[model samples]
Target: MTDSDIGYLTPVIDEDGAPFWQYAARGQLRIQACASCDELRFPPRPCCPRCRSFDSTWRRMSGRGRIWSYVLPHPPLLPGYAEQAPYNAVVVELADAPRIRLVGNVVAAADAPLDSVDPELLSVGAPVRVAFTAASGGVTVPRWLLER
Candidate 1:
């Protein structure tokens, strides 16, 4: 089935997180970095959590990471996610910035379905690399692929 047929949820981009989506559209992975302390932050907050600095910059990442954790969603799924049940949602810790982790799905390729990868293959600390998929509403999301 096509992506639209699966009815994937699109991210709600706000002022603080707009840059993150924009970078993803350009096939780049960036995180909010505190201008003062140079600490990277996730979820795109306005101020730095470490130093409480409002001034921040978008820093490009290496797009390489290791799986920190994961979950396989069961029944009672959300409206658009039921068809993709048994899919794995992973938390990946960036190789360059261990403290910064990103949540995403692990697929075989950029356009693969959420449940493309065998669930039995997923493991914590498994090396992964980034892949981008263009979702609805002109947004590009970063997904993960198992590194061979």
Candidate 2:
């Protein structure tokens, strides 16, 4: 696997979140769900916040979402992303789970630089689809592509 050129920070995978990353490696967007309550959640945890159950499962999302909000950072806070300044970081609300939002960069294509898309092109409620890119340490990170 090759690391993305943007050098974006890698996600810290924990026991509860491993499955999500595993699915992403295969280009699937899976979210953690409470087996008991049937509620979906992100930033996976061992216990369901709603039902307080230890049983959990992963649900594959449609990979479809809307850009709930976005920002083009003038000077990226992270040093590694400095070269990719003016790139967009978007919060996408899943079409299947509106309350489950994911934060990621919107690029022109999978593996494209963070700033690949023009900042002026982004807007709230813009349609987007999930794209995965290999990042440092054999981890795949999710990015977004504007659905045009």
Candidate 3:
């Protein structure tokens, strides 16, 4: 099946996470940070857990990370992704922000197919970098690439 036919689900953008998608569209990896305590946060929310402040700003990251963990699914959870079964779904721990982690697929290139990389190459603590791809509805999703 073609990449278009793989039908990856588009993210559900909300007020709290809008800026993230915006930055991703521009090929930048940004995380929400607390203006009060200087703490970085993921799954961006309005309030800062450390300072109990509602103030926050977007911080650009190095776009560098390491695979904290990964899995290759069989009999894909969604029928639309079945053709891409065995793709690597990875949990990446950001290099700059150790406390934050993000889940995404690891592909050979920015816009490559989900299963483009061999599953055997995946491992915990492997270095990776962030990549982005435009999705349906003007949203951009982050993908990962192994650091050479």
Candidate 4:
């Protein structure tokens, strides 16, 4: 990876999130869905909060959402994200799950600098959609931006 390249180094899949990451590697966005109540959840887990059932499935999402909240960090950022300071990180409300939201980075384009989006462009309730970014190790991450 080059110094200017900004992205996750390796697949960070935990015990509960392994399936989600594995699916994302194939250009799919899989989120946890409660088998009982049919509730959609992000950041996969073993048990559903709504139904409290261990039974869940990997459901593909439309990859479309609206910007719910955003933050442009000051100079200091947490570890790996520090290099991309001033970047807009947002919580996106998926249309599929009006109550659930996913966190993602709002960027200009796939090839554009990760930190290039100006703060003026971001606003609450902005319409945004997911774009799966291809990366090494057969990983595809959902990067967000204004829907075109």
- In TM-score terms, which candidate is top? 3
Could you estimate the TM-score for every candidate?
Answer: 0.90, 0.92, 0.93, 0.81
Model 2, CA-based lDDT: 0.89
Worst 10 residues of 3 by lDDT: 1-10
Instruction: Write down the RMSD of all candidates, one decimal each.
Output: 3.1, 2.9, 3.1, 3.7
Instruction: Report the error of model 1 at residue 44, Å.
Output: 1.2
**What is the per-residue lDDT of model 4 for residues 1-148, given as tens digits with 9 covering 90 to 100?**
2222354444555788888777876767778898888888777788888879998888888888899999887764455567777787789998777777888788888645568788888888888877777665655667887875
What digit string (tens of lDDT, one per residue) describes model 1 on residues 1-148?
1345446667888899999999999999999999999988888999888888899999999999999999998872565777777789999999989999999999999999888999999999999999999988778999999998
Q: List the global CA lDDT of all models.
A: 0.90, 0.89, 0.89, 0.76
Ranking by TM-score: 3, 2, 1, 4
Q: What's model 1's lDDT at 145? A: 98
